[model samples]
Target: MRQAEKRAIERVASKRRNKNSSSSNDEFEAEHICIRTCGRELKCGKHRCQQMCHRGPCPSCLEAIFEEISCNCGRTVLQPPQPCGTRAPECRFDCTRPRPCGHPQVAHNCHPDDLACPKCPFLVEKGCICGKKTLKNQPCWFEEPRCGLVCGKKLKCGTHSCNKLCHRPGACEDEGISGSHCQQLCGKTRSCGHLDTERCHAPYPCKEDKPCQAKTFVTCECQHRKQEVKCSATKIEPSPQRPLLKCDDECLRLQRNARLASALNIDPQTHTNDHVPYSDTTLKLYRENPQWAHIYEREFRVFAEDRAEKRLRFKPMKAHQRAFIHSLAEDFGLDSESSDPEPHRHVCLFKTPRFVSSPMKTLAQCAKICASQDSSTQQATIANDATAIPYNALLLTNPQFGLTVEELDAALRKEYAAHPTVKFHTSFLPSDEVVLKGSGTWTSQTLEASLTALKSTLQHTVRRLKLAENVFLCSVDDSLNVLRREGGQAQREGGWSAVVGRSTGRIRMPRDR
Candidate 1:
C-alpha cells in the first residue's frame, strides 16, 4: 500500500516537471527569435558582452554576460570578447555613461590611476552643444566657443554670407533657424515696394527726388545774353554756353585790320621799293626837265677834252713810238687782237721815269736794233777771226757770292763734264762774272739747247749751295754787242744801269769838241 502511494506521488511530480519544462522551452524560443532572425551565435549570458546587442542579446543577457569580466577600474561593465587569434582585438571595456565633469565615462583596463579614464570630453551624437552637426567627435574640453559647419546661405547684402560655421554653446546671443548666429545686416523692404537690401553707407537719390533744374544766363558769341537750363543737382553736363569772351564790332574791326596789315606787309610787291631806285629817279628827272639835258652834254665834252690831253701828254712820240711799242707788244703776246680802230692810248707808257728824259728807244725799237747789232757783230767777228773755230760763249754772273775762284772753277768743271759732246773753257771776269766758251760740232739749235742745259745745272748747283740773290746768264755775243757801250768807261757800267742813265738825259757833252 505504501509503494502504491509513492508511485501516485511520483507520477504527479513527473507531470508537474513536464509542464514547467514546456513553459521554459516556450520562453527560451521567444527570447531566441532575435538570434534566429539575425543569424548570429547566441550572446546572451556571455561573459564579454557589455551593451545589449540589438540583433540578438537583451539587457539581462548583457548584464549576465559581463558579470565576471571586471574592468581595471573595478567596473563590472566590459566590452564583448573577440576571437582568440584576431588582429587588434578590443578585449577591453569602457563605461560609456555621462560623467559629472561633462565628459564621457572613463575607459577600462587603463594604466596609472590618473589615466584610468579618457580625459577628453565626449562628442554628442547629434552635434556639439552648439547644435552644429559638423562638431561631431570634437573634444568637449575646449573652453572657447567652437564654430563648425559652414553657413553658405546668401546675406541681405546680396553677397555671400560669412562662411564660418555655427558658434559654440555660449558664443552667440541670437541664433537663426540654421542653428548659426544671425549675421544678416541687410534685406529690408523699402517704401518703393522694392527689396532694397544693399548695405550702402551713402544712398543715391533718384531722378524724381532731385531738385528742379536751375535757370542761368549765358552770353552768345555776339555778346548777347540768353537764358539757359542747367543740369540737375545730381547730374553734371557741359556748360550751356562755353565760357568765351564775346567780341564787339569794334574789336572785330581791329582784328580784321591787323590781319590785313600783316598780309600786306608780307607781300613781295610792297617790299619791292626797299632799295633806292637811282636809275628810275634819274630817268624821271630827265624826262621831267628836258632843258637840263644840255648840262650833261657840256660835262661830257669837258671829260672828252681832258682825256685827249692826258693821252697826248703821256705819249709824246706818237708816230714811230706808237708803232714800235705796238710791234713789241705783239711779239711779247701782251696785246689782244681786236678790230676796234681806236688807238690803245694806255700802251707804251714808260714804267721808269728816267726813260722819259732822253731820246729813249721803245721796247720795239730796242728789240729790232739790238737784234740787227747782234747779227752784224757776229758776222764781223766770224769774218775777222783767223782761226776757223766752231765755238759758242756764255757770260754768267757768279751765283755764289762768297765762293772763291777755285770753287767756282770746280763747279764749272763739274757742269762741263756732264755734257761730253762739248769742250769748254771757263774764265773769270771783273766783278762777280764768269765766261764759258764751248767748242762743239753743233748747230744753232743744239748750241742753244746746250746753253740752256748748262744754265739749268748751274742754277741747281747754286741753289744747293744757297748762293747769292742774282745770277744772270746771257749769250756772250748778245751781251757784248747789244748790251755794252763802246768805251772802256762804259764797260764798267752795268747794261741795265747804263741804259737807264743814258736815256734819262744824263749824256755827257764831248769836252774836246
Candidate 2:
C-alpha cells in the first residue's frame, strides 16, 4: 500500500512538471516573438496570426489587453510608470490637462491625453471642430460650433473665424452669455408727452414718414450754370450763326490757291502776263503753278525753255542775209557743186550792211546775224574794208560736210602754193572756221583771186558738195554810209572828233572827169 502511494505521487509530480514546462515555453515564445510590423518573427511558431508585426503587440492581443485594463472613461491604459526615486517616471499617459480644467487624476496605464477618447468630456480634443489635429488641448468648438463641412462661412463678426471643426457663426456659448444684454438706450418722445425708455432692440414711438424734397435742376448746354427751374429740353437748338462759322468751299479753294501762289513766288491777284518778269515764259509758268512745279522742272521746263530760246533768240536769217549767204554758198560750191548739199553745211564771209565803215561796231552785230542763220551754219564774219573784201574768212568744210581734214588741208595747201607771196596764216577754228589772216596790203583783187582758186580746189577734191549757192560775196555801201553818219554824230557828241576823222577818212569817194 505505501509503494502504491509513492508511485501515484511521482505520477502526479510528472504531470505537474509537464504543465509548468508547457506554460513556460508559451511565455518564452510570446516574449521572443517580434511585435514590430516589419519584424521577421511576426507570429509564434504556431503561425496563428499569419501577418506582419505592426511595430507593437498584435491588434487582437492588444484589444484583449486594452479591455482588461481599460479605464471607465473608455481610454486604453498606457504602460506603468517607473517607481519614485528610482528614476523620474516616464508617465505613459500623455495628459496635457491644465490645472484649470479640473480633470480627474489620470489612472495608471491610461492615455490621459488620448484625444480620440470620446467618453472623457473634460479632456478636450487635440484639434478644432474642423477635424484638424493639434498638440494643445483645444476645445473642438471653442470660438464657435462648426464641423469640417460648415467651416469658413461668413460669421456675425464680419470676419472668418477659425476654420476648425465644431466652429459656427456668432460668438461661442460662453461669450454670448457674458455679454447678452443690449447696451443702447432709446430717447424718443411718446404720444403721451413723456420720454420713452427702452433698449435699442425696442421700437421708437415718435417716428414720422416724410416725402423726398430733393430738388432737380437744368442748365445751359454749356453746363456753366444750374437753376431750380426746369430748363427747356427742346434739343438745345443750334445758334442761327452756326452755319456761318465754317468757311465755304470757294473760300477754302481761294486760300489754297493763295498759299500755292505764295510758295511759288507768284502774286495771286495779278492775272496778267506782266506779273511774270522773266522773259522766259516757261520759267514764269513754273513759278505760277507751284503745285506742278516738280513735274514741270523734271519733264517740261527744260525742254520748253530750250524750244522757246531756239525760236525767239535764234530766228531764221532775213532775206538780205539769205541772199548774202547764198553768194557764200556759191563760192564754197555749196549751191552748184553737188546735186544734194548737206543742209546748213555752208560757211560765209560778208560785210554787215550796218557796220562796213566801223569794224568795231560790227563785232556785236556779227554774232546776231550769224545766229539768225541755219543751226548748222558754223561761223560767219563782217569786214569794214571799202572794197567789201573779206580780211578774215571762215571755211566750214568739216567731216559733217563730207569734207575730211586731209581734203581740206590739201585744198588749202594747193591754194597757198599758187599764191606764195600772199603772207597769210591759216588756223582751224573750234567754231569750224578756217581763219585766213593777211597783211593790210592785200587788196580786194588779190583776195578775190585767192578765193576763186580755193573754191576750184574744194570743188574738185571734196565729194557730193556744192560751192555755188552756199557761197556769197556782197557790198553794202548804202548800209555802211548810214551807219557812218550815225557813228559820226555819236562821236561828235562824245568829243571823239579825231576818231571820227580817222575812220571816215578811210572811205573812198568817187571822182568825176
lDDT of each: 0.42, 0.35
Q: Which lDDT tens digits does candidate 1 get at residues 1-513?
A: 668856765776777667767784655422221212233333442334333235434323323222234334454444546332222223245545455566545554433333345566565534444554444555565544455566554443344355556654433323353432344433332332222333331233322233224332333343222334443332242233236546566546655664676676644234232222123333333344435433532432343334222111122233343443343323222221111113323232211111111112222333345457679999778654523322255555434445565665665678778888887666554333456666678785677578667776776776676653333434344344222211211133455564565557544332211
TM-score to true structure, per model: 0.18, 0.15
lDDT of 2 by residue, 388-463 (tens): 3332332332323333445445555755676665654444433232334433367756765665556555445433
C-alpha positional error of residue 57 in candidate 1 after TM-score superposition, expressed in Å: 99
Each model's Cα RMSD: 44.9, 41.7
| Residues forming the 10-long window of minimal summed lDDT in candidate 1 | 350-359
Best by lDDT: 1
